[model samples]
Target: MDPEVDTTQGGLRIDGRRPLELRRIRLRLGVFSQADGSAYIEQGNTKILATVYGPHQPRGKSVSSMTKATKGIVNCQYSTAVFSFGAGERKKRPRGDRKSIERAQQLKHAMEAIINLELFAKSQMDVFVEVLQVDGSEFCVAVNAATLALIDAGIPIKDYAVGCSITVSDKLLGDDDSGKSTGILDANWVEECSPGVTLSIVALPKVVDETETKSSVILAHGAGQRLHLSQLESLRLRALQGCKDIRTIIDQAVKDHLQIFVVTTALDK
Candidate 1:
């Protein structure tokens, strides 16, 4: 822990947020005119752009052959710009690297879990995510951006898929009061690069009934450090809450976009 890194002030985090608070989220749908659907998202300093295309013919014979008549094919490509890093740092390639390939596969699976593949059987859905800035939790931000893009394309989905990252650190857990073991929600770049266990989770937080009881179905979980059995439950809870919060934000954004779109179309009519 950095001695200068102040953990909390008046029950808020060093970034002036509560322990379970997420960074400010800003998003816009239909960002690109040429793509079938596109969205841009910013979670604090991390910015990502995602585009969706197809539900059309498969690009090549290999893809066509693999396509099932009962289910749609989902293809995802995740890339980061050369200047995505901070000052004095640069990437050699934008994509095709080992990390990028793994992330792409992960994004594909996440999208597959939520989308109604049966409706687009024998067709392909292409998702491309580009990281314009890298502050932290790039994978989570990419997943969120892709979800918005899919919605913009009017793709049917069972529910919203949200992603969140958590970091478990004793330093952050200890408040001035009772010092209970806690995890930080939505860890930033500095927290992620610090010494601790970090977990990334993607889940669909569905509200089952009017009572507001929510059930979270986790689609993916990735860990950056070894976690103890005793700490797993707490970390999972925090991550789930973060996912739910993110889902609420995204749902609102989608609704707002639709409202504006409807008003614009009516005026043009």
Candidate 2:
């Protein structure tokens, strides 16, 4: 861990932002006319684009039957462009890698949770989340992007899904021996590669439906380290806060998007 990376000093960090603060968020909807729904979001150094298609027909018969006639199926395929890497660096190929496949699965699961699967029935909705830039917490960034895309597509969801990552640092705690210190909030790549642990959480901001079954709700939680049991609560709370913050931002963006939609529709009329 770089002792110089400590936030205590006046030293400037990435984007001149302070520790525990998220990057500036920018969101745009209807980015592409070809897709049923499309959105783009920029979180700090990470930029992502998401597209939603379908609620139409299922490509395969096997999974197609899984969707109920009243409920729609969520078919997600997450990929990153070769140039989506930082500094516009070109990637060799866009797909077929093991990591990409796993990412697609993660996104599929997240989308399945929010979208009421029973509405479209025997139909499939394809969600493609693409990472245009990766600085840190790419998974969280992609999930957020996908949420906006779903909204743009006019897909009904129980709630918006927000994801966040946390990492501990050695030097930040002023004790290299205590490499397990918990750093609440965002963790860059350097912090991720260090001796610290990382946790990624995807959650529904608030359970608005009291009659709905909460236990069945999906909460994707990943922990890399065996931290002290006592610290678990704080980590969980902080991650939830991150999720809430993301929800707030997305909620506002959704409102703005709808306003634009109303204006556009009125003009067309």
Candidate 3:
């Protein structure tokens, strides 16, 4: 943590937000005509574009043989534009980099957790995510964008998969009358770069039955900095809340998109 950096300034973050508040999220689905489905999302400074192609035949016999007859294959590629970084310098390479490869794998697993792969057995779905700007939480943003693209593609999914980033800061909670570890939701670049532990989570939140609610299933989680086991549960809860909020926002966007599409089609007729 920067000596001058305060987690909460006048009950607001450095960017003028409450500890639990999220950055402004703007997204659009079906952004690309050629792809089976596509979406673009902007979470504060980080912007990503995701496109999904195919529920078609596997490209090779090796892929076909490996894919179970009851489950489909999910392929993901994560890339960052040369100008993604705000700094003047450009990147030497994007997709082939080691970090990018790991992110691509992570994204694949996250999406696979929610998608109903059994529905399209022996088929393949390719998701490609391109980061236009990266201030923080690039992986989370990519997952969200890919989910929207999958929805646009009309792929079957168990539920919406949402992602959120959390950061823990003791000083942020020091102002409280009762001392407790403070968890900040939707951390930005500055907070992410700070000394505090940053955790990114992707989860699915939905009801199972009237009397019983299914526990929020965490599809993926990545952590930075050492975090104590004692604080893990609280931090997970905070991150879950962030994920719920993001899911609400995304659900509304999907509804809005459908309404607009319906109205446009009616008007055209």
Specify the poorest-scoring 10-residue window by lDDT in model 2. Answer: 210-219
Please estimate how well model 1 matches the true structure, expressed as its whole-model Cα lDDT.
Answer: 0.83
lDDT of 2 by residue, 23-45 (tens): 77888988999998998988777
- Ranked by TM-score from best down, the candidates are 1, 3, 2
Off by over 4 Å in 3: 1-9, 61-68, 170-177, 207-215
Candidates 2 and 3 compared by lDDT, better number: 3
Best by TM-score: 1
Q: On a 0 to 1 TM-score scale, where does candidate 3 land against the true structure?
A: 0.90
Which scores greater on lDDT, model 1 or model 2? 1
Tens-place lDDT per residue, model 1, 1-269, is: 35124633565556676768899999999999899999999999999999999778778753657544678889899999999997879999999999999999889889999999988877889999999999888899999999999999989998888899887766564232456557778877777776677788888888676456474655556556678887777777778888887988898899999999999999999
What is candidate 1's CA lDDT for residue 214? 75
Q: On residues 1-269, what C-alpha lDDT tens digit does candidate 3 reach at each position?
A: 35224544676677777778899999999999999999999999899999999898888653747544678889899999998987766878978999999889989888898998878888889999999998888889899999999999989888988888888865443133556765788877777776668888888867555454344755656556788888778778778878877887898999999899899999999
Q: If scored against the real structure, what TM-score would every candidate get? A: 0.92, 0.84, 0.90
